[model samples]
Target: MGLDTPRPRAAARHPARSSPPRRSLHGLSGPPPAHERTPLIRSCHMTHRSRRQRMHPTNTPSRRADSPIESLWPHRYSGVMISIVIADDHGIVREGLKRLLEVEPEFEVCGEAKNGREVLDAVERSRPDIVVLDITMPHLGGLETLERLRNEYGDTKVILLSVHNDPTFIQSAIGLRADGYVLKDGRAEEIVTAIREVMKGGSYFSPAVAKKIVEQARSPKSKSSDPFTLLSAREREVLRLIADGLSAKEVATELSISTKTVEAHRTSLMRKLDVRKATELVRYALRHGLIEP
Candidate 1:
């Protein structure tokens, strides 16, 4: 035991103690003072704040002031609304067309008319970009209205809407420089597409109408047998009115013509159509689409 004492005081006996229980920051009364905080904790707070700032930046990009037109109508004419006037003899037809056209953001229906006479008034008042006109309106026919518009408002585009796909009607519209021809029986989208095409400085026709036009172009004699083509515009107007059961005096008043002139037109119509009686004239007008049956 003598030299063993030098061997180490038998390594002093000590009680085995478990590791101290871990303490969470949340469980603490408060965070340690800033200087007492560990570099790792401070670094974590700074990193979290930096990440939040990066995710939700305060600044936003600015929009250009001169891009309103580009933003509104990126695919169409810059900044311009395509103004339109719809003319149809039937109120329901006009209402339907208005409702259909109003859906397009770029289209604006500026005016409406029930007949060709009102069409002129609407065009004068609104100065619209396009006119969708019906062919067989009362008082003034569509072809006559188109001619007047071509003369008065040369810049305004005209699209003819007709139920007839006859070559005579198509040729007449083409001759009058109609920008488009859309049949009433066509799909509703056809009219919308026609307006867009006409606005683009191009022409559009229903497939049937286009085919009729091509047929007429190929055969000039196709319309010769149709006696309706032999009638003058004034004579046609007289026939339509006469067929509607208007007397010579009423026709004169409606047309602002003398009764004698109306009688003369009646005679011309009868001679051209080879009809002797007023009843026959009505039948012919009905058969030839001069008046609504």
Candidate 2:
């Protein structure tokens, strides 16, 4: 055999190794398939976002977030017009309210009332969803109307439109569970916003009124402003329970007394407090710390 040229050893067989696929912003040679990609993409994105935020600190968010009230009143999705009854003692005021509300397509002026009596009648006849009430109406006031509405027409909501910004008035309306409170001097838009907010099952107060409430909460209380000094401890307890929205029978049950006794205490407290109605008593209780608003 011609000295066989030593056969060259076959190159050692080896598996081909592939390089990692490169990411392409222009999608020419696109990123690796999902399963083959590294898991750090999300982490890289988050890191970039954190650096951007640190470079530009913003006081207000770029987009306004949804308010707590936005979750309420699913009926809003149904697109039903919110019916409203405007109740003010002054004809001029009622006319202005009617004019203001008429412009909003979402609202319907179901009725107008001069006083609390007419308000009741209007509510019975029209069955409006909301009542924009004046605090100082004759015969029955806003708080009284609110109380009766709570007792009789549980579905109807009330918003107190008033000139008064006193803490006692604010506390009273809140205690009676008025859905909204707006100052007469505030912009007309405020009333509209209040209506929307209240219908959303949220309370709204004028900015000034809210500020006053905050300041009062931070300030020291004076003995002279303490309404509790006018009543005995027993009377105070009864008022407290009543202000808590307990009926006479309920109060009696809670206090371990007869309903008659509860009624007597209520009457006595009303007279001593110079209040004519249960709503007024509740407001007094709220203002004096006999009960919470």
Candidate 2 structure quality by residue, lDDT tens digits, 1-293: 35877767887588777876653322215644454332221111133345345334454232112533334432222223567889998999999899998786568787899877789898888777789998766445566667788788887888989887777667667666788889999998899889988877788999999987787677747322745444544566677778878898987886568999988988888777777888888787667544434
lDDT of 1: 0.79
User: Can you write out model 1's per-residue Cα lDDT over 1-293, one digit (the tens) per residue?
Assistant: 69656655575488778775543322224554454332221111123345345334456332343555445544432223567899998999999999999887567787899988899998887777789999999988888788889989898899999998877677778877999999999899999999988877899999998888778768878878688777666787788889999999999999898999999889888888898999999898888687876
Model 2 bad stretches (over 4 Å) = 1-79, 219-293
Q: Per-candidate TM vs. native? A: 0.72, 0.53
- Candidate 2 clashing pairs? none
Deviation in Å, model 1, residue 4 alpha carbon: 45
RMSD of each predicted structure: 20.6, 19.3
Task: Show the lowest summed lDDT stretch of 10 residues, model 2.
Answer: 37-46
Please give the CA lDDT of all the candidate structures. 0.79, 0.70
